[model samples]
Target: DTAVSQTPKYLVTQMGNDKSIKCEQNLGHDTMYWYKQDSKKFLKIMFSYNNKELIINETVPNRFSPKSPDKAHLNLHINSLELGDSAVYFCASSLVRGGNNEQFFGPGTRLTVL
Candidate 1:
C-alpha cells in the first residue's frame, strides 16, 4: 500500500526530447506538488495543485508543466529537456488541515539528459 508513487524511477533521454512523468497519491489529499532537486540537494517547488487549481512558482521555466486530472493524481511534463534539467523530480501530497500540513513524498524520478 504505497501512499504515493511515481512511474519510471529512472529516465535517460536526449537533451532535446520531451518526457512526462506520472504520479498518483492514495492519501486522499487535496493538495499535491511537484518538486525538483538539483545535484546540490536543494529542493525547489515548481508547481502545486490544490483541488485542481494550479499555483506555479515564478522562477520555474515555462518548459515545465504540471497537470492534475483529479485530487489523487498529478502529472508532470517537461518540454525541450536540457542538461540542467537532469535532476530528481519528486511528487508530494499533504492534507491541508487548517495549517497542520505534513507532506508525504513519492519515490523520486531521476531524469538524466545525455
Candidate 2:
C-alpha cells in the first residue's frame, strides 16, 4: 500500500489559472508537508501541517495554501498561477516521534505553467 499519494501526476496550465493538487496519506502520520522542487532541483518546504493545524508556513506567495481537511489529507491550492509557480510539487507525511521524522514522499505532481 502506498503511504503517500498525489493526484494529477502532471499538470499543464496557462498563466493566471487556478489549480489544485490533492494528496492523501495512509501512514496515519500526524504531520504532513508540501515541498516545491524548482528546475534547479532545489527543494523548499512550502508548508507543514501537524494534526490538521498549520505549523510551518514558508515564505511563499499568498496564492499558495495547504488545506488539510483531516490528518490524512493535505491538498495544495494555487490561485493566479504564474510562470514561477511551475515546479514539481511533492507531498510528504511523517510520524513525528522522538525527533524522528522519516518522511514518505509521493510520486510528485509536475506543474507546468505556460
Candidate 3:
C-alpha cells in the first residue's frame, strides 16, 4: 500500500485546458499539502489543508485550486492551464504540528503543456 499516491503520473496537454490531479494518503495524517517543482528544481509550497481547512496558500495563480474532501485526500485542479504551469506537482502529508514533522511525498504528477 502506498503512503501517498497520485494518478496520471504524466500529463501532456494544450495551452488552455482544464485538468485535475488526484491525491490520496493512507498514513492517517491530519495535514496534507501540495507543492510545485519547476524545471529548475525549485520547490514551492502551493497549498496546505489541515483537517479540511486551508492553512496555507502561497502566491499561486488563481487558476490553481486545491480541494480536500477529507483528511486523507487532497486534489489539485487547474483551469486554463498554461505552458508556464507545466511542472511536477507533488502531494505530501504530515502529522500536523511541531517543527520536526516530516512530509511524505507522492510519486508526483508531471504536467506538460504543448
Candidate 4:
C-alpha cells in the first residue's frame, strides 16, 4: 500500500484557471507538508500542518492555499494559476515524534499552466 498518495498525477491547464490536488496519507502521521519542486529541482515547503492544525506557512503566493480536513488528509488549491506555477507538487507526511523527521512523499502531481 502507498504510504502517501495524490490524485490526478498530471494536470494541464491554461493560465488564470483554478485547480486542486488531493492528498492522503495512511502512515498515521501527525504532521504534513505541501512542497513545490521548481524546474531547477529546488523543493520548497508551501505549508505545514500538525494534527490538522496549521503550523508552518511559507511565503508563497496567496493564490496557493492548503486545506486540511483531517489529520490524514491535506489538499492544495490554487487560484489564478500562472505559468510560474508549473511544477511538481508533492505531499508529505511525517511522524514527528522524538525529533524523528523522516517524511513520506507522494508520487507528486505535475501541473502545467499554458
Superposition-based RMSD of candidate 3 using all C-alpha atoms, in angstroms: 1.5
Candidates' TM-scores?
A: 0.96, 0.95, 0.94, 0.94
With candidate 3 superimposed using the best TM-score fit, by how many Å does residue 52's alpha carbon deviate from the native?
A: 2.2
Which is better, 1 or 4, measured by TM-score?
1
Q: What is the lDDT of residue 86 in candidate 4?
A: 98
- Local distance difference test, each candidate: 0.94, 0.93, 0.92, 0.92
Clashing pairs in 4: none
Model 1 C-alpha lDDT per residue in residues 1-114, reported as the tens digit of each score: 999999989999999999999999998888999999999999999999998689999999999999888899999999999999999999999999564689999999999999
* Candidate 4 error regions (>4 Å): none
Each model's total of backbone clashes:
0, 0, 0, 0
Q: Comparing 2 and 4 by TM-score, which wins?
A: 2
Q: What lDDT tens digits, residue by residue, belong to model 4 across residues 1-114?
A: 999999989999999999999999998998999999999999999898886578655579889888988999999999999999999999999999764899999999999999
The RMSD of every model to the true structure, in order and in angstroms, is 1.0, 1.2, 1.5, 1.3
- For model 2, residues 2-84, the per-residue Cα lDDT tens digits are 88999999999999999999999998888999999999999999899997578665479889988999989999999999999
Candidate 1 minimal-lDDT segment of 10 residues: 94-103
Quote the positional error of residue 89 for candidate 4 in Å: 0.4
Tens digits of per-residue lDDT, candidate 3, 3-104, equal 999998999999889999999999988899999999999999999888768866658989988998888899999999999999999999999666356999
